[model samples]
Target: MKVGLVWFGDDLRSADQNILWRAMQEVDFLVCLYCMEPHHQRPSRYATQGMSENRRRFLQQGLNGLNATLAKVGQTLFVSSMDADTSLNLILNEVPISHLYRNHHGGWDEQQTLKRIENQYPDVRIQIDHGLSLFTPSQLPFNLTGLPESFSKFRRLVENVDSTTPLPSLHKLPPAPSFNIHNIMPWQHQITDNHSAFTGGEEAAMDQLSDYFSTNLPNQYKAMRNELDGWENSTKLSPWLAQGSLSARQIKASLDVYERDHGASESTYWIYFELLWREYFHWYATRYGKQLFLPGGLTGKQTQGSYYAERFRKWSQGNTPYPIVNACMKQLNETGFMSNRGRQIVASCLIYELGIDWRYGAAYFEEQLIDYNVGSNWGNWQYIAGVGADPRGGRHFNLEKQTAQYDPNQNFTHKWQGQVYDSQLDSVDAADWPIYPTSSN
Candidate 1:
């Protein structure tokens, strides 16, 4: 009986996980492994920490949950701080392995890592499953290279295409092969006791989905999704989705059940529409490759801005002149979450108002967001910076107009805006700024 190894990357859950299911079927014994790379903890090029404390804490909770879940199925997840290649080498040397199974990711960095592994081990029977996206390349109506540049065109083509059904839940797994490997990486960060709305794990993700759909929230989602704050205002599923604790197909499956039971409305269908947007960005990342990360973005046009360190710092710390931007930034800095409309508004301010390099903002979001997906993060930044797929070239939101409409009563703004600090800018008069006066209503 040949031993097999399953490497868990972003795909952490056992439910709807094709890689884990197929590995269990083919191997007599299996070992589940995860690599905690040093690069993930270090500061990025933009000088922001690669992963924020909030996100790190969430990841730790998720890992602990996954280990407990695996233990129930007679398996254990071995975690190490070593690089993926070194970790895999240690496993192969210690145990006689015949198969390696992993979920495929569309990011350039992730793809490069897989390529390096293949080069190092030529004889291993590696099987890569496309579990990251709702639709795979082969399932697409056209070749990835020829994917439509505009999202609306792409959505029109594939809106009716059915997603493959999610894999059935696994209740048991083959016992892991015993191996003596030490030097397991210890989680050094302190888990904060901050009261967060989200808790990590497969169970939590499913519970959240069930709770949201069980209410009238889905029916009101289309109308309320743009609001600045509130749990019920929008479906808070991205964090789980980003970590692979929840799969797109799983969400779609739940949506199907909801629509059948409650009757489908534009709101019910709108959830599907948002999922398509996520799918578009996932495939777009693969097609564009390294260009997606480049300063020029997919269009190869240079963004018209230079890095302004002080200005960016003020924006990030929620000390900006605009109350709406400040409040949104404060919310993101405090909680590992922000509304979709808030994201667009802040992104527009960074690119158009502050005139800082877009990559810095994108990199900062990567560090801070609990639900950060490389494709969506970078792709959307490119769109706002006028380098990606927006027919209008770029998005520039009028801060005054946005605030008047979205934060009219100043309820959302007041909740997040803390004590005012000294202005980072030298000459700007705080009183002269057009922000909604804190003294008024």
Candidate 2:
């Protein structure tokens, strides 16, 4: 019987997955695999690990759901902490694999890994499906090399182009090949807090999407998206979207339904607009390759800021003098989530006010954000640091002005600042305190 393997990377869900669906159709028997790379646990240049506790927890939840879904269809997801190359080597040795399928991620490292795998195993038939974006590269008006430099230009070209309809969720799978694979690694699970707003899994993603659309949230999204805090302010679909538990095309399909039922408005259109921004970055990363991660971004312009360890530590800990920046950072540190407005505010403060390297800030966000996307995270940092496709050199947000506009009454600031300040005080001694005013004070 023909044997095939499906390697789950960022694409974790069974729904609307072309790679999974195609693999099921083409093979008599299939083995589903996931490799938990060690790189995720190691510290990055920014002095932060790739996956934070919150992100790890969320990922584990998603994996559980994926595995359960597969089991219902008489298949089991084989997970390993071994590197992709080594894990695939072991699997290929055990089974006479006829074909391998995986989603095409645009990161330079991902591309390099695929190349290395193909070189190592020339006999195995490998098929790559571009499942990450709302529109495939072939569907785009321009090729990767010819992608527009700015988002507006890119949006104009593809705005009218139809997004591919999401494939229905797979309910059946080919029988798993008989194999005694005992070396699977344990999933690192964390106990999530009861009050946590986000949960991982395709079910959770759909539920959030359903709940958000059930109300007038999408109607007011454009006006209230910039609010620093509140669940109702924005569609919280990003974390799932980042992990591929939610597909961009799936969201677009729902948006079309909402517009047909309720009249289309700027708010509804803005949702598609943001998704286009994500699509732009995905292609941009593909075009630029490793340059997206370099100090000099796509433009090859060197960042003016230098790395300061102390400043970076303070920034990560949300101890900056700017209360607005602190609030945003603290929110990220605690929840592994932050509003888009909060991200921009804190990112600008790190690059412009703190004079720290933009790459470090980008790397830190990759470590902290549960919703982290390599293209969006690095591309945005490059934009803010004046190294990417921004028409303006860079964004420099005035902290006072931002605080006044977003938190006029200091409601958000006071909420986060008190927690951070109290935590800082707990580590200090009386000698460090200024009970009596010193001349310096």
Candidate 3:
């Protein structure tokens, strides 16, 4: 029997998954696959692990959710540890596959794997689709080659495009599918002893989305989105979005429905606007690939310095002596999440105040964040570090000024001060946190 194998990458969700849906249509029997790539969890030249325990746990939850959903439809996601090329070769040999389908992952490793699959199995029909962003290249105002450098320019050109761009429909799985359960190989690398906060699966992601919009949370998002005090202010849908457990289009569609049935407000519109911002970054990364991850960034003067493991450790551990920045940094270290405001403050402190390398900061985020999207994380870091697309770069957040503006009452500072580090900045006589250099991604 001709069978289809659906490859899962960072895109872990079953819903709105073009590859899964396409596989269902092409083969009478099908299977889904995910490989825990070793490189993803290992440290790069930056001397930090690629992912943290909190992120791993969150992904596990999402994966579990995806597996449960698939089981209900009489199919299963077979997860293994072999690299994509080796795993695909083994699966193709065992499953009698006629086609291989997957979503387009823009990472360098993923691109290389796709090439290997095509060259190795020239006979197999491999279908790839774009479902990660709200605006795919075809639907954009210009080809990626001609895409604008500034986000404002890009947003202005593509903001009003029709939502219905013929997205692939989610398909029902067959009652039973040909299997290779026993043939699964052991993971090539050592699984980390640490666990992550978010689980990797579809059901958990759907649960998160349901909770975010099913209540008054969406209504309160705009008001509290900038608050670093808690998680209630924002939808916190990024981790799901990053892993493809949820699509930007799906979230946008739901927002439209929510606004129509409920009343449209600034909060609702703002969330959609941010999603578009995220969509902009995705396209931005695609339009300029390796440059986004570079030290000089897409737009900066490249500077290299010693990787002072000590200062970086203090910063990452949230003991950097700056109250607001430390509090946000502590939150990220503990929970694998920080508010957007928090991200800006801490990242600014790292690149500008600490005079640390921007690459170290970027890699640190890549290692810790559950919602670590190469495009968004690196793009924002580069922008903040004065390297990326920002016309004017390097945001050196004044701790006193920021605390006065965002935590005027000092409640936020007081609450988190002793928890992570001494309330060093709380002292009136302390020098305003030092600003070291001009920088961005």
Show the lowest summed lDDT stretch of 10 residues, model 2. Answer: 418-427
RMSD, one per candidate, in order: 4.7, 4.5, 5.7
Which runs of model 2 end up more than 4 angstroms from their true locations? 185-193, 418-441
lDDT of each: 0.85, 0.85, 0.75
Alpha-carbon shift of residue 217 in model 3 (angstroms): 4.1
Per-model TM values vs. the true structure: 0.93, 0.93, 0.87
Distance from true location, Cα of 241 in model 1, Å: 0.5
Candidate 2 lDDT over 106-203, as tens digits, reads 88887887888798889989999888898987898887889898888999999999999999988888987887655654343434654568888888
Q: Please state the error at residue 55 of candidate 2 in Å.
A: 0.5
Q: Which TM-score value belongs to model 2?
A: 0.93
| Candidate 3 global Cα RMSD | 5.7
**Model 2 clash number:** 0
- Residue 41 displacement in candidate 2 (angstroms): 0.6
* lDDT tens readout by residue for model 1, 248-298: 999998898899999999998999999999999998888888988888887
